[model samples]
Target chain A: MGERTIIPFGPQHPVLPEPLHLDLILEDEKVVGAVPSIGFVHRGLEKLVEKRDFNEMIYVIERICGICSFIHSQGYAQTIEGLMGVEIPARVKYLRTIWGELSRIHSHLLWLGLMADAYGFESLFMHCWRVREKILDIFEETTGGRVIFSVCKVGGLWKDIDNETLKRIVTVLKDVEKETKKMADVFTRDYTVQKRTRGVGVITYQEAIDLGAVGPTLRGSGVVQDMRTLGYAAYGDLVFEPIVEKDGDCYARTIVRVREISQSFDLIYQAINKIPDGEIDVKVKGNPNGEFLTRLEQPRGQVVYYAKGNGTKYLDRFRVRTPTFANIPPLLKMLPGADLADVPVLALSIDPCISCTER
Target chain B: MSYMPKSPWLVHYDASSCNGCDIEVLACLTPLYDVERFGILNIGNPKHADIFVVTGSVNEQNKSVIKNIYDQMPNPKVVVAVGACASSGGVFRECYNVQGGVDNVIPVDVYVPGCAARPEAIIDGVVQALGVLEGKYKNMVKVAK
Candidate 1:
């Protein structure tokens, strides 16, 4: 029998894009237990709502995490809109959906690249990011920022794309789809990738449900829980189904994200095709006087946003429950008994966004 | 300041950031903006790095980690603080835990300022650090004599 020893995993490691600390209690090469610690990137963003007005608060929320910035802003805007009982125009809904899907595609591709990098596939990582550049270009061209698109607002959206530009976006997405398909084939079939990821970290369906996992982590476990089905934005105007994979392993999570990229593309195409001509935003009047909760299906998982207004410009309380926060308990659950070598990949399988969690 | 090494190794460290800057730093390594063409490699170990490219603001929990990495780097090293948060704590300056920018913990040679500094700006910051590295190396040679 080997003596159990403790090893600190990180606040900084090579593969992790965000800061996270896990104290791994290891018995020889296998991890026996783990204690997770956060707050490294906590910016106290929720507290900022006290100072900034509801309309301006979207910027703060968007910066909660760069990768999930758009969705964060979207969720917050939608929540405040709901609170104020501001009914935005139909065109605004379609634009929001299109942009939301774009953000999802980019986020999923970024995760895919990071996943490849975790297993030491440098060339594959570069190739995945190369395709991601196209998506970023589209963001820069349309919304003016590659990472933080400050286009979402309280009433509706801050900007609109003409049908001609919308057609161009659809064209670019088609090209991105072609490139992504090639990468998907490599990810699903490559021997080395499969060897590293497949069956490496398995969480049963019951365990996922019990742990309250969300997003691809839960969907990967065969649970069809998707917040988009709740019909936020223009989702009700389009056909939608939650993508579910039966296997509860690292490979299943990977497949779920890969498949989602195509799903997002199709959703965007549908949105552009059905989008009608109308004003993008309505004049938002008065302050929100009640509390409302908004749920968004982010790239990683389901994020719940809660906003409490006091009939003033300033929000009384703003709280966010990011997907990574909900997935952390499940991450801890899966870590014990995993090989030390598998810790990085297992942690990444949840697509842990520490900034989002801490913020 | 004649000695500009053929290849400059950079170690990226995140103290407390939203990761907008960190991903942009990573983007510099990709095919589109491959800073590798400029003989820059993103190394993981601080001890082997010629430049310290830091993203994110300094915070109570990470200030020590930031200092540890800075002290570990070899002499003639230059530090580039990328993004507005790294330069002056940006939007998170008011947070309770945020101590300030990277300069609060270590001396900064170049400050690249942007909410999330663009990749081109980060690459330019690294290029600027090369000059600092050259100056520091020359000063070391002069001190030895």
Candidate 2:
């Protein structure tokens, strides 16, 4: 097995829907080492921020990665708001929390669908996405876009959710919760899914922390840390604990995400119930001053945004440390020694967003 | 040969995108609307593929690679431009580094429109491409006769 062949697993692969090239040194069917080459989707987003005004930069930042669009926008906006020392309205914070949780549910459902497809569970894939479409519909109705919800503005949200709209959201989410529970039962308890994912890509608790894995990937490894626990945006008011599992395997990550979706549902319900009546946003007087750092809990993990703004309409510098970028090290750790056939599932478990990583 | 719908293996190439369109492209292959049922499966190598699904607008750094991939695909292959960015540069059209839609680099057989085209639209475009493939195959049969 020492005399092994090196195979390139992507830049283009059917099982992996993202543009990532992994050179896998294989001994028979098992991977000995893996080298990942990204940047296929690098759009020069960081450089583009220099050209746009800080106000207009929200749209650009939101486009950095579509899967975590809301988080990117929220991070950038929060950074600018922090620099400006602008306290966002309470109502807006609750709204942001609701939208953020919705984004999480949709993102996890999408991951579940992709993982199912990777393991040849075609029916489960379709069923998961079929439910996901309902979430997208909600996004389209609330934010006016399916993937890039450009709803986060500098001071607060771009729009407000009326009581009627909030009621509708609650009603819709209740139905979604029931269906999702059934799906979670299948994903967590089903023999076939467990066999394919359990004990696969096992990353120990110490290894996950050392590798800087975030989101469900790290939480599955028994780390109860969630950036949202720090109380950004209305999460402080929500009563919940970060979902954690001890196994830290592919199946554990799946369970963490499935359970987290239910948690998001409860968080959204709380947001609707506790949302106070107030102005959605405050008028900004001038450009933001000084450097600001903001961290937000995205569906994938913790996303950090830093902005240094001069006393001008355009920003001096803006940088985003996306969750997928942080999880890459952990991905590299888990890939070696695994069967070549399991590469796609392991990759999906971390939920690599190449656009986010490269951006 | 009776008309067997040749399920052309698809190779996805991301030149420069926000990944909104990339995820939607994956959605096309996922279960709710299984594109594989039509025999279209995603392959990682360009040499083993018959269709190129190019997402995002082509960037200067990736232009050569995109062209190389397009050329590597076997002759009689089809290229489908997915998403607004791949179709007309979408939001990133005005960026200096962009070379506009994928058509600037390769001939596209079909265009799936949307900032990030929906999975349903992607399925429609792929089905339409299959029809085009059948037409081309029939022409070859006619020439052989």
Best by DockQ: 1
The candidate that wins on lDDT is 1
For each candidate, the DockQ is: 0.76, 0.51
Worst 10 residues of 2 chain A by lDDT: A41-50
Q: What TM-score against the true fold does each predicted structure earn?
A: 0.98, 0.91
Give the C-alpha miss distance for residue A214 in model 1, angstroms: 0.5
Q: Which stretches of candidate 1 lie over 4 Å from their true place?
A: B1-4
Displacement of the residue A63 alpha carbon in candidate 1, Å:
0.3
Clashes of each: 1, 5
Which lDDT tens digits does candidate 2 get at residues A53-76? Answer: 888888888888888788788788
Clashing pairs in 2: A12-B44, A13-B44, A14-B42, A126-B31, A126-B32
Question: Deviation in angstroms for A233 in model 2?
Answer: 0.8
lDDT by residue for model 1 (A288-338), tens? 899999899999999998989999999999999999999998899989889
